[model samples]
Target: MTKERIGHPPHPFDPARDPVHKRSKQGDSVGGAVVIVGGGYSGAMLAARLAERGVASALIDRGGDFGRGVAYATLFEGHLLNVRSARMSAVDGDPGHFVRWLETHRPDHADPDGFAPRRVFGDYVQHRLATVDAACPGLITRITGTVAAIGTDAVVLEDGRRLKARAVVLATGNPAPRTAPAGASERVIADPWAPGALERIGAEDDVLIIGTGLTMVDMLLMLEGRGWRGRATALSRRGLMPRAHGPRPDVPAPLEAGLLEGPLSGRLALARTVAGREGWRSLMETLRPLTADAWQAADPAIRGRIVRHLRPWWDVHRHRIAGSIAGALERLKADDRLTMTAGRVVAIRPGAASVSLDWTPRHGPARPALTADWLIDCSGPGHDPARDGLTGPLLASGRARMDALRLGLDLDDQGRVLDAEGRADDRLFVLGPPARAAFWETIAVPDIRKRIEAVAAALQ
Candidate 1:
């Protein structure tokens, strides 16, 4: 089975090594079951597993129902997951679970591992929910409401309702992208996640994008689909692009033979570890479980250093490009329709028809002006805010502290939320992308699935 991408050396599970950090469970209990918040992939997977074990759970979401988090809430028929289906599984051990599910459901399927549309994945999650629900009638429940407050062992709903359970799981997904620097005119489009945003802008309108990460990649593909013929500019801190993943290899891992113990020299250190061990893909596959250890072992001073100096490169290395999507981006580059500039947007001034961005180059005083008919903020997901999502309100009120790295909420080694006094909340558990500060590579599906499963077991 395929593992999550961690890019560290591997190790077989050793109970003696105690990879799992311990938690203090002596404080409080709401009795027999737990309530899962944020019903996306993480919530769905955990709910399925918990219900399978005969433990009842309340799967709650404020969105458009089950499986429709930020990623699947769109009305588009063709929005796709960046990663292929083969690697996207709700179960931690069953790597091909999603692929097999799609095969059984969609008989006319042409590509299983290929990037399928968002609706297809959403349907699969819905099917799993139905399957799990049918297996355990009255054992699992779904609630559609926004959570206004999370107490010790209870969640207060916005509608003045309360849900009390033995434990709580926060599987809240990534937040939406922040809006672009606003101008007086409509030339600047802030919320790209809004429905029909890409469709409203025509192919002939010149556009400017804020960031150069995956969101930019999605927009680039969308533009290609719309036959956008006008010039585009992607401006970011580095203007660095993402790297593409290689072919999958099934070689048995040789990295599990104790090669990960030292201060690795460079890229060659990685090469030597994987020597005669596995293909590049195989090596990466084995390293998936050890990245957190590596991240924790990494110097804290250097941690911020890495974020400042090497974040762009790290993002490209971790978040690879799909082959077909890469081909589309290549065509855009070849046609001279897309240009990536490394600079800072000092200000956005809107004219009668177009928006002009005042720019300053890296270490150069020659500040030039760049203009676009329309501007979209592709700067990636939001962090803490006052919205009704996951981390916003708690952070705003100091119920929980943000990580020193500013990565998400402060969490313990076992994924317990650390409150304002730096103590783990006994009744609360946290998982998903925002946990990245504590568990560096925990955002992806595979790693997140394992964490959810492990935490579920711990709760049991």
Candidate 2:
């Protein structure tokens, strides 16, 4: 068979004439005090928080079971948390719950400091759900179905049902697996979380993953779990692997009370403070509590500047991987089982059995071509309205609109949803990553836990 090549396709934009577009699938009326459209970390924590506040809440999940979102629902045994057990509790009220659980349950398990199996973490989240079930403080329900539409004050399910509520939370974790480059579909493994994503590999098969972040780590461990010995290549702009978290360093608070009130000069002052700190982990640990303040202090203009200059560096620095995962990656690099190439993808061609990829490596004169038996788009995509399959129609139809970053539903400072004219919707509320404009570092469990608490408090 002739080797087919592939590369960068195009930026996604299609509300009309797009094959993936669909209308709202309104379900039967199911009234919830607060209807959350996702079942991930953010949604689960918010549900419990709402119950604590004596509010009725219901969560609808596509996966059906309670605690398993795309990030947590992997059946693969080798997938582990990038964070340590101490930082991984599903609930913010009990910071050490995960660590305590590990000690009580899997004390004998190896590498407790390293990444723990994602299954155990998922189980802990499930257990939290079970606890909420027993309490019955306020109405919090879970439905197993897809989300079809999100109205101004209601959530519509795929089965043509709607849950009109005072608030709606879009806690859908990560976006769907990206569509591969044109002609790359034959060898594309679009969804990493899908069943048999790694199992499709043969012992001698070569694999190419689009990014070298946590998902790549998951893929590595999954293959290692299956005893599949193969060559894998990861490509990205920097090709920089996530930093492994070592012993928690003693990072002092970097900013004072006025540090958050930023206008470029103040930000420089904070940058100087960070400069004094030892490393990225120390910088983040100090900035954790102060993040919301800093985020709110900067106007959208500064935020955009940061996105352009600092976001990529911040991601690698802040989102450090587990020590064990990093160690394994180091070993793989040493053994040449795993390889990472730094560059932008130029093209791809999917053949019957293998996909050919063309990449420009770090401004190097020569663009290289490599073939892999399978390719997974680990380059994380945003949970755009279209990908979520619920809010997209509303946005295109002028019922709603995207924020500056085109992430989640747009909202005002007080957490009120914004309509197409950039006006706040009185009866609607948004939470989690969709509210990222209000809270920059909100994707983490610790951050989400705190946000959920505030969301609950605000609702009361």
Candidate 3:
């Protein structure tokens, strides 16, 4: 055994091509320990928690830093965490863990309520994993490769390497959005966070961004940070921007009485009732803690109704932006530098210098074709794993199946992956976004941290 750097491995290790394996007839095995695929926040926190309990685990991820993944791997200085530092802890029971770590590590921006740069958070995740690795030598194995398929007792890589383990966890984060419409300009960027995605845009070139969620906010900020002076148009079904976080009062009133007691008719009724009393923002906060249970208790038909009728409204209110970022957006709007429209793009015509988008307004007649120098897709990730190449194999072979809502992979209450036959696999577990179908609120750090802690305890 040789000592090597945990994260910055000398080179990518292909398990199938390991020369040392030739010395023995045994196939590649991680000693039958828990092997976590995807080293994002979910995987890193899971591995760290397991290590804390004296359990060694194997972590496998694709390119980039082990823990950053897509969200925190942003190189743009303007990309900030949507949540405050106080609530972004990677571990349960350690509420101030992330802020405390930042105090010693980066005192300049260590305020508990401050929203830190996303890359800083990424560094925090990597540091957490690194600390665990240091305390428990040889307890965490970092593998750099993608898992092509999952076997009953092992994971097979794309290169034909096998890692035998007692259990496997899929923490694979968000998948890239689907490809752009045909005949669209080559300048159309499906993944806004992709490296050099915004590099080719000129200072005065007009831009059109699809989707008006947090991802669109990120793109707007990135463009503004780069001193983009071109006109920008954001299109979505509702064209609603995320709300801004505000100063919390010293004391706040409890949620309105009977807000959650009565028979639920629909999201609109609930929203109007709550908003009439405590306001929509407060209503969201009040429901945030109970979202998982509320979602679980509701029948699939009710959930589907909410997803169809109230998702956009709930999304804008639920996922908010930093006050500063919201202020910048307002400034952009005030200066006529940005415009948001509620419509759906019907067709795209690409020209040599610009692309024309034909869209129909939500309630009005179809508008004239709008042209832009660049088009970006900020519609967020596709939720169907059965359609994704990486996770499709598992679904095709009955290792996993889509949930009723098709929002994410199906899993049991204990985070165990349910097979196509609807049987929980004791040896397989899932964490993070893929588990959203089972746990609607499983994507965020707070929700994922609890899930990771529970899964770690189960594995231990």
Candidate 1 C-alpha lDDT tens digits along 370-459: 888888888887755345455666767666787777767888878888878898876778878767877887767767877887777766
Q: Candidate 3, which ten residues in sequence have the lowest lDDT sum?
A: 7-16
Candidate 2 structure lDDT? 0.69
Misplaced by over 4 Å in model 3 are 1-29, 179-185, 249-253, 266-271
* Ordering by lDDT: 3, 1, 2
The residue-by-residue lDDT of candidate 2 on 240-342, one tens digit each, is 7788786653355554554455466666567666657655466667666776766676667887877776777678867887676778889988999899889
Question: Clashes in model 1: which pairs?
Answer: none
What is candidate 3's lDDT per residue for 94-166, written digit by digit as tens?
6777887788778877998889998999999998888767755666889999788788888888888888888
Q: Which one wins by TM-score: 1 or 2? A: 2
- Superposition error at 234 for model 3 (Å): 0.7
In order of appearance, the predictions have TM-scores of 0.82, 0.84, 0.89
| Per-model lDDT | 0.70, 0.69, 0.79
Better of 1 and 3 by TM-score: 3
RMSD values, in order shown: 7.0, 11.9, 7.0
